[model samples]
Target: MDSPICLIENLNGTLSVNEQAIDYLMGLEQKIVVVAIVGLYRTGKSYLMNKLARSKTGFALGGTIQSKTKGIWMWRVDHPAKADRAIILLDTEGLGDVEKGDSKSDAWIFALSILLSSTLIYNSRGTIDNDAVEKLQPNRYVTELTELIKVKASSGASSADDEEGSGSQFVQFFPNFVWVVRDFTLQLELNGKDIDADQYLENSLKLKKGFGKNISDYNMTRDCIRNFFPTRKCFVFPFPATVEKMQLLDTLEDKQLSKKFSSTADTFCRFIYENSPVKTILGGKTLTGRMLGHLINTYVATINSGNVPCLENAILAMAELENQAALEDAFVMYKKEMEVVKALFPVDSSHLSENHLKSQTRSTHAFMERSLKDTDGKYSAILAGKIKEYANNLFEENQDASEKKCKALLDKLSATMDHGVKEGTYSTPGGYELYCDHHDTLMARYRAEPNKGVKAEEVLEQFLKEKSAESSSILQADIKLTENEKHIQAEKNKTSQMAQEKAALDERH
Candidate 1:
C-alpha cells in the first residue's frame, strides 16, 4: 500500500505545475481528468511513474508518504498535447509484509481505503501465488476489500468479477478479481516431497492432511479470488540487462506506460462519472426536453451557421442581442453546480483525480466552450433571428422610393421569368416564397388545361377561396386574379363587411 502512496507522492510532485495550469484553463471552461497508478511496492511503481513524468513535464513536488497517512495520494501529471488537460495518477502500496508492524497495519488500512475508493489493481509480477496471497487467514482487510470489489463490479464499472466465497461468512462482498499479471515469467517453488505442481487433486489431498481447517479456508479464499478474477489483464514487458540496464535507467525516466494505463484509467474515471449519485439528480434537473430540442434547433439552424468573424465576434453579436453575459454566466454556474453535484454523489467506483476527467475526453471542454458562446443556449432561435435581421437590413437598404417605381421593376422582372417558377428567380423574400411558388404553379397548371375531368374554373375558384380564408390580412394576400370570379367576389364582400363593422365600432367609441 505504501508503494501506491509513494507513487502518488512522486506523481503529485511531477504534476503540481500542470495541475495549476489546468485549474486555470478549467476556470476558462476547460476539463481535466486524472487517473490513479497503483501496484505493490518495488514493483517498478516509482520507476514507471518517473518515466511517465518525464514524458510529460517535470516531476510533481509532493514528498514521500509519512507513516501517519495511509493509502495512496493523488497528483496531476502534465499532458504534452494540451496543458489545460492532464492525467493525475495515484500510487498505492504493496500488500502482505510481516517485518514492518506499523507499516503492515498502514498497508491494510490503505488497501481497504483503495478498495473503497478505486477500481482495484491486482498488480502482480508473474505468478499469483507470491508472498502476498500466501498469508490468507480471516482478516478485516480481505473482508473490506472483497466487499468493495462487489460494489464496483455490480455497478458495471468493472470488467471482471469473482464469486469464490460461497458459504463463507464474508462471501457476499468479494467481487470478481482480475489477474494483472505483467511481464509473464513463471517461477515454481519445490517442497522436497512427492508432490506434483500440475496435479491439483494431489496438492489438495496433501494440503488437507498437512494444513487442516486453516488450509481449507485459505483454499476457499484462494479459489474464490482465482475464479472471480480469472481473466487476464496481462502484458509483456522487456526486462533490461545488468550494466546496460544501469545506464538505461536514465531512459527509464523518460518511458511511460500510457498504452498500458489508458484503458484502465478510462474505465476507472468513467466509473466515477457514471455511478456518482449526484449525476442522477443533475440529469433529472435539466431543462425540459421540448425546450432543449428548440434550443438545439436554434443553435444548429442559426448561430452555428451564421456569419461571424470568430468566437469573439460571436460573443459580440450575442452581447448586442442582449443575452451574451447571461450565456457566459450560465456556463459558469453550471460548472459550479456540477462540482457540488460531484460532492454529493459518493463515487464508490474508481478514485480518479480531477485532471483525468478533462484529459481523457476533449469533448467535455468543447461542450463547455460551445455552451459559453450560446446566447441563452437557444441556438436555433439565435441563428434564425440573425438571418431575419440581415434580410430586413438588405430589404430596407434596397427599397424603392415609391409604389409605382417598385411595381414597374417588379413587372419587368416578372416578364423576364416564366409566370410559374423557371429554373431560378427571386419572387418573395425569405422562404415565404413557398406561397408565391404555390400560386404560380397553380396558375400555370390552370392555363395548360391538359386534363378535362375537373373544371378549371371550379378548381381555380376553390384554390382562391381557400387561400383567401387562410390569409390573415388582405394586403398580404393575393387579392386579384380575373375580374369576375366567385372566390374574388366572396373576398370583396368579406372585406366590405369587415370595413363596415370597424366603422360602426369606431363610431360607438
Candidate 2:
C-alpha cells in the first residue's frame, strides 16, 4: 500500500522538497484526479477525507478544533471504482478559525484548494443557508489572490486576471465545486412539492440579495456561488456523528462512527469514485505525482513571498517544462532506434543487400512516428504540435546519418575498383559482374533512406563507366595478339617449303 505525500505545510509556507516524495508522485502510472475538502474549521473535513482515502488513521482528524490542517496535505490513493486512475486527496485547513485571525489566509486556502482539486467538496455543518454561501465569496478574491500567490503567468502578462483581456485565461483554472451540507434536519417538502438539493440550491440562488447584505463583491453571495462553480453539485449528509462522539473515536472505522454515519458516507464516497473525471490543470496536464512538486513550489513560493498566485500563468510555466521533458525523452529513444537500424547493415560487403536495408529503415521510421505521437500528453494540440516539429528534426537527423553511412560504403567500392580492373576480373560479356553485385547490395542497404548525400545514382553511373573503359582495353589487347600470331604462321610455312626442296636434291645425288 502506497502512502500520501504531504505536499505543503502552509503554516510556514514550505513545500515538501524531498526527492523521495517527488519520485513517489512521479512514479504513479495512473492518471490522477484530486478530491479536496474545505469549509469552516472542525466540520469533520479530515474525517471525511479519511473515508475517501479508505484509511482509518490518516490526515490527522483534529479533536479540539485548533485547526489540524495548516496548509495542504495530499495523498495518492487508488480510486474505489476506477481501475485506470488514482485519487489525490487534498485535505485543506478549514476556514473561519478566529485564532488564525487572518481572513486572507482563509482566502488563500480556498484558492489553493480550487487550484489543486478536480472535485472540491465544500464541507459545512448544519443546513445550507444564505450565510454559508455568503462566507464563500468566490467573486471577491479574483484580484487579491493573483498578487498574493505570485505565479509566473503563461503570457508573462504583468496585468492581473481582471485586466480586460485575461478573463478566459483565468477562468480555465476553476474547479468543479460540490457543496456538501452536513446535519441537515429540514424537510424536503416545500408548499406541496418535493425538492431535491439541486432545486433547493437553484431557488436559494434565485434571489439576488440576501437579508441585511448587499452581496459585497458580486451581485450577492448566491450569485457569486452560482457564477464561480458552473458545473456545480450538492450533497446533504445526516449528522454522521455528534462532535462529542467523533472526538473519542480513533478512526471512521470505529463501530459507533460507522453505525451512525456509514450509509451516508458510503453514498458520498461512491459519488466521488464513480462520477468524478480525471481533472486536468490548464487544459494541458493532470495533477499527477510527477507534477505535484513543482506546483507546490509555485504555490508556496508565491504565497510566502506575498505575491498572489495567478494560476493560469503558473500552469503555463509547468506545461512548458513538462512538454520539454517529454520531448527530450522521446528524442533519446529515437536515436537509440536509429542505432539499431544501422546495425542491421552488414559489417562487410559479403552480406550486403539493398531492398532489406530500405525495408528496415522504413519500418524503423514508422515506429518512431507512432511513438512520438503517443507522447502527446495533457497539453495535446500545443505539445503535440511541438512534438511534430521535434520529430521532423529527428527524421532529418536519421536520414543524414544513413546518407553518411552509404557514402562510406561507396568509397570502399571505389578504392577496390582499380585492383579488380587490373586483374581483368571486370572484363567479360557481363562486364564488372563483381561490381554489379556489390552495387545491388549497396542500393538495397540504403533503399529506405533519402538521397541526402553521395547519391546511389551518381555512384552507379561512375562505376559502370569505369568498368566499360577497363573492358575496352582488355578487348584491344586480345586483337593485337591474334594479328601477331597470324604473321608468325605465314613466315614458318615459307621456311618449311625451302627445307623440303633441299632434302629432295640431296636424295637424287
Task: Tell me the whole-model lDDT of each prediction, alpha carbons only.
Answer: 0.36, 0.63
Q: What is the C-alpha local distance difference test score of candidate 1?
A: 0.36
Clashes of each: 44, 20
Q: How well is each residue in 1-509 modelled by candidate 2, as lDDT tens digits?
A: 36555666555333334456556767775788878888888887887888888877788877885887776777888777768888889888778776777677678777888777778888877777766665565334434334443333543434433442333344466677778887777776668899987676666667555555454433445544555567777777776567577675554445566443577677778888877768776545555666655675666667667665666556655656655555455445544654554455322222222432443355444434322223445434443454456444544554555455666665664566557666766554445445566556655654544443323455455555756765566566556656777888888887888788889988899
Please tell me which predicted candidate would have the highest TM-score against the true structure: 2
- Model 1 segments more than 4 A misplaced: 1-34, 51-71, 78-86, 96-100, 103-119, 130-132, 135-143, 146-184, 187-215, 223-232, 236-238, 243-509
Tens digit of per-residue lDDT, candidate 1, span 1-509 = 11212222212112111233223323332233333334444344434444444333232322233222123444444444555444334444443333233333433333332322222344445444424454332243443344322222123222224332231322222222222434434433346444322332223223233467876655554564443333213232334223335333434432343343444434433443332211000112222212222222222223224321121232234333334333344334434543542443322122222422342233234334434334365743443454345434423322322223333333444443334334433222331345555557546644554322213344445545755643333223333322235677899999999999999999999
TM-score of each: 0.32, 0.68
Task: Report the alpha-carbon TM-score of model 2 versus the true structure.
Answer: 0.68
Runs off by more than 4 Å, candidate 2: 13-30, 97-103, 129-172, 183-219, 241-245, 248-255, 258-260, 281-296, 326-341, 345-477
